[model samples]
Target chain A: MSQFSDPDATGPMAQGVAIFGEFVENAQGVTATVAVIGKKNEPLYLRLFDEYQTKELYFQSLVFVSLDVIDECVERKAMQQDMYLGFLCPIDEYQIYGYMTNSMIKFVVVLADVHRLQDFELRDFFQKVHAAYVEYLLNPFAPLDGDKIKSARFDAAIERHVATILERPPPAPGPGAKA
Target chain B: MSASANARLGEQIWQKMPKINAEFFTLTYGAMVVQLMRDLEDVQLVNEKLEKMGHSIGCRLIDEFLAKSGINNCNEFAETADVIAKVAFKMFLGVSVEVASWNDEKTSCSLLVYDNPLTDFVELPPNINLYYSNVLCGVIRGALEMVQLRVECYFVRDTLRGDDVNEIRLELKEHIKDEMAEEYRRE
Candidate 1:
């Protein structure tokens, strides 16, 4: 089994890190941390699921730190066309992925190392989150400014998406896998 | 126009208009009402504000209604009632209202709304006495006023208040004449 030893391999190599099929069996217990950042980089919504709930502050700081990388990625002309920024910088044992909407709102997800998720799966997750966010914004009570999202409905929607990701079936093994 | 014809027209217009998710619209309106209640701290004031806001929306929406429906005029108050219940309601809200209870003078009637999108996900607290869909009345009043019809509209019954159906009572006060032209002729 290949280990993600080099944290600096944040280019295409890091995005392709999901190729490690060996970790598929142990993926059920993987925890995820989700964050929403406003245009001014203010934290709008942050949620940590399962085991990561205890380390709330740690994940909060990590999500804030990932904003710089997201900003740099967004500034690049080539990456502007695609909302999904792929695998962002890795911090400690978790990997960060970023997605930005047309209105400049940013969504970050941090996943524990044991799980394996394909690029398309991550994109799907972000798309669902985006749909929920749009619905939340449609509420006239939800201010357009940098106010933190405090709606119970919004929280429930995000939690449902996170649950789906956690319960997703692992990717099928490739032809080169050792049986 | 026949009721069926108006229904068909409303359906056609509804198809042509750009649409958003119904749930989103419902939630947005619900949240707005809740926010108004919190800020105003008076159920009556919130109801008035909602009506006022709907009045502005109606003033603008009438132009759209005229443009899209290609309706030049309604010759009688009865015809106007039919158009409002069958066409206008369906065109904007995706639901058709039942126009009933016309008095002998035919100047007053009630529009029965069986399915109100605004109150789809809403359940009012027992302590709160509010007209959640009062904006619909304002919209009708404002729209009719633009067409030179002086009408009084108000919620007679609300499904939120355990009524069998939502009823908006409409009473025509007068048919406004061309006051500006009359003044000019007098001068």
Candidate 2:
């Protein structure tokens, strides 16, 4: 039970970021989900939930390179609307999505297009992850040292959130498609 | 805070302040130490691991602290110290901490955590370097570093180690500039 407090209500912005790792939906499937939230120059937090058993060292290096790429984009003021929409990378069948907060905390997500998540759906996905991250950060007992997110609550939350988003019916075809 | 900000903060605090049994909390700390001792068999390693873990927590936890506090950014080093001792400690641990021993310049200071929930029942064996509460030092250092103020925080004395008081000494180093273009271009 939550102790002592008034009626509370804050959104994802109250928390930071979550899931700096990469994970494919299934080894049986052709697509995966990857995310990163970290500093550019100084080594802060980078995680990869790799489902394909890539070498740990390799994944870490890729994250640094991705961080550098996103940093360059931000520096050039190329990110007009959103980071993910700005620079989506296709590296060896993996498509990347990036999001940078004004605070310089950059978030990146990756998946194969064969899995083909639409831009709005990806936006919704990031939003859910953001909320899960907030829940993770609010836990006083959570240890800070490692890059890997060890919170079961966060994992469970993200799973539910993502499943809900994916399970929803796709938006209808635009009126312009009437031929 | 504006009405919206206040509502947000209230919600955050509600989620953060889960009703926890103090005894359970104490026991968990005890169990953590005991497990570390068994696994590594070196008190120094245990201390090191705990500090590293604490630093990790501090790095992430600070953002939540800042967001929920709703005071916007802090101005000076002294003010930051006060917020941690007063607001942060009070909110998380339900304890009031005393900030004292400031150097003439107010760049350095000592924090006395009189009623530390982590070390409430800790009775360390006769090891001077135990630093049973070293995680506090890491948490302080980690949390402070994120706010762009680099400081060296360590224990001068610990009540668990038979010291008359539990004290942490902090000395400010040079302020950290935000990560910039020149820095990233090299990387």
Candidate 3:
């Protein structure tokens, strides 16, 4: 029924495969997702908010957008945290949102209410969220769940992933077996 | 205050006003005070010293206010008190006050605590004189009273209660014409 399940679809394809993976990895009620947004805020890639309903994180509502969108949004709205490289925009129905961008991608992080967080707490929290964003980017098969990765660890994982990507050298031949 | 874009002195004063970056200053100062109170054994003497320090700081801040606002003079003691609470608090701590009672002779003001850095995780040890943030109240009282107004100020509640929000209540007693007489007696 879904295009994801089409038999004729070329290359790697699986239905409920991502879901099954999610059930195992996110046992602590934490999940991270990614998405590609098209024109008019239309999400083109996988969405996290739509799929997982049970698991919960402190930062329940966060979205990641491209760097260009971040620049555009900054013109209209204030940036939530100066320490984190992100812009902020207000959505009437959604309350508040954080728009993050690096050279690679754009991120929109929506929240129920951020006024509770002080300036320092807000900055630290955003830094963590930025780290999580990078981790989600590195995982090739990690289902881009749009807004699913709300946990602080998810953000920490992003930091670790980023440090690895930036620090690690190319893989060398193991055991001298292959030429 | 010069409105020109290249007004260096105006810009420097603006930045030093504390309100421009009050959050960082408040957080840092509050943390230092908290650590000091925890580490030191003498809470009473420390409190008095802190209050004395606040008194001097308040006096200087008044000069800054006059320079920036360019106000000729305060008409009455109540008006002077108003400027002291409003402009000084806004510039230094990023807070404002509500005047509970004001008369021709005396004035009473209340500083409704919103989010103060000094009051964070602050517990009042049984004795009244052991309060660390009493410095802030002393600043208000000492600054205004120096100009001839009597001030009775204290905390409404212990901030460490963790149940209720904090409030610092200030009661300006009465106006005295000859402040020098009272100052001499105290001296």
What fraction of correct interface contacts does each candidate retain? 0.17, 0.00, 0.00
Candidate 3 per-residue lDDT, tens place, A52-149, comes to 44422212223322334455655655534333443355432232334344432444444323233344544555565455555444332223444333
By lDDT, who's the top model here?
Answer: 1
| Candidate 1 residue lDDT tens string, B19-91 | 8899878887888898898899999999899889888888888999999998778889988998999889999
lDDT of 1 at A127: 96
lDDT score at residue B152, model 2, on the 0-100 scale: 87
**Model 2 stretches astray by more than 4 angstroms:** A1-179, B1-16, B181-187
Tell me the tens digit of each residue's lDDT in model 2 across B15-84. Answer: 5776698867866876777677779888789889888877888898888877777666766778777777
After superposition, the stretches of candidate 3 with alpha carbons farther than 4 Å from their true spots are A1-179, B1-23, B72-78, B101-106, B117-132, B158-160, B174-187
Across A36-127, the per-residue lDDT of candidate 1 in tens digits comes to 98888778888877532434555666787798898788888454578998999887667999999888899999998766788999999999
Docking class of 3: incorrect
Report lDDT per candidate.
Answer: 0.80, 0.61, 0.47
The superposed Cα distance between candidate 1 and the true structure at residue B63, in angstroms, equals 12
Which ranking of candidates, highest TM-score first? 1, 2, 3
Provide all candidates' interface root-mean-square deviations.
12.2, 17.5, 21.0
- Shift in Å, residue B36, candidate 2: 1.6
Listed in order, the DockQ scores are 0.08, 0.01, 0.02
Tens-digit lDDT track of model 2 for A1-179? 11111136232212111212233334333233444353434433333343444333333344445666776777777646564444455664556776666655565665555666677787777766666665454444344453445544455555455455446432233322111
